[model samples]
Target: MTDFSEQDLSGSSFDRVDLSGSTFRGVDLSGAVIREVDLSNSRIRAAYFDGVRMHGVEIPDLEISGEVVRLVVNGIDVVPFVEAELNRRMPERALMSPTDVAGFWEAFGTMDRLWGETTDLARTLPPEKLHEQVDGEWSYIETLRHLGFAHACWIGGVVLAQKSPWHPLDLPWDEAPVHEGVPWVRRIKPDLHEVMDLRRQRRATVAEVLDGITDKGLGRRVTSATPFLTDATDLTVADCLRVVLNEEFQHRLYAERDLRALGAG
Candidate 1:
């Protein structure tokens, strides 16, 4: 059981090496070439795969969950097909990608309505249950907190040019990088009302932004001063709002699923 850490193993070659059950953390595999590698029952998390290509691979019973774009598999880009099927199933999923002001309004409206229903359903659960994690997922309260963080980052920080727009209870995603002056506390057990008030405030801010948005406004580029997103200058106002919408919609679905497992909803 040899251990390697913080070592520059660049330009190294290991042919016919047995590395089953090896742990790789903060390891860079960029520009590495390999053939006949077995990754069965292997778990890769918080990793980036860009401009990668594979050939003559046997991939079955494999499940990938994350942001995917331009993923060519077997001479077919499956992203559009996956998106079409998701839109067909969820219907409102189509609204997340809006092309006009009306569509944006509708998309946000749908999110507001659905989140309203979800929070109402959450209120029916035991107060302590709201803070309990299901299947290693975020608790209901944490979901709301993360959504608030999303709104603050995309809308307040980027569009409104706020240097620091994070609430004390704001919760970033699990894989988010540590940033100074940003709240990422996970052990604080905030009550439902406390978190709900924060959510209402954030939602109102988004609503106000939507109220005066024009098609031209949507196309205007926006940048963030937050250290995590300082390089996101290519984003437009519409792109930022769509990110918030996607986070809200997906997290609500996860909350609902966890709520059902908690014997509520």
Candidate 2:
């Protein structure tokens, strides 16, 4: 066994080296060349792949999920096409990127109504099924918990400028880095009702903020007390709300998909 920490292995060359099951954390590989590598069954979390070019790659049964700024495939940038298709499938998604106070409120209202319906569907399932994870995704309960966290971070913490808005059961993303004074309890199994209570409180906070929002307020810059955004500048109120809207919209779809997979929908 070997270990390398805080050591610069720049320009290091290896041939026929077997480093299977090895761990690389906080390592720099910005310009490293990888060839003929077998990355089957490998997991990459919170990674950056800017300007990465892959040719002659076999990616059958591969799943990639994240923000897509631009993805070029065979000389075609498909991000716009994908966005257009998504907007066609989910008409309300086009509203998620609203540019006005009224649009923001409408977006939130649509999300609230949709979530209400989804939660109602969830209630018909067995109590234990709500805790079950389908395809290794977040369980029903955990999805709600993560939504609460999103609300707290973007709405309560950033928009309202609160120092601490996290609830005890609020769950951050699975790959989120640990930060002081933020809740990230993945093992806690609160009943659906308890989580719904938290959801109501979080939703109320958004409502209150939206009630007083102005068109000018949407463009007003705000900073967050959350560690992750402490150094973020020029974050507008509208930007924060849009993040919550996207999170809510995407996570609800994920929850609904998982619920059908569990045969509980």
| Candidate 2 Cα deviation (angstroms), residue 260 | 1.1
lDDT of 1: 0.87
- Clash numbers, per candidate: 0, 0
Q: Once model 1 is optimally superposed onto the true structure by TM-score, how far is the C-alpha of residue 112 displaced, in angstroms? A: 1.4
Error of 2 at 35 (Å): 1.3
Q: Which candidate is the best by TM-score?
A: 1
Task: Give the distance in Å from residue 74's predicted Cα in candidate 2 to where it truly belongs.
Answer: 1.7
> Can you give the lDDT of residue 173 in candidate 2?
77
Q: Where is the poorest 10-residue window by lDDT in model 1? A: 223-232
In model 2, the number of clashes is: 0
RMSD of each: 2.1, 2.4
Identify the runs in model 1 with alpha carbons over 4 angstroms from their true place. 1-3, 15-18
lDDT of 1 by residue, 51-116 (tens): 899999898878887788888989999999998898899999888999788998899889989988
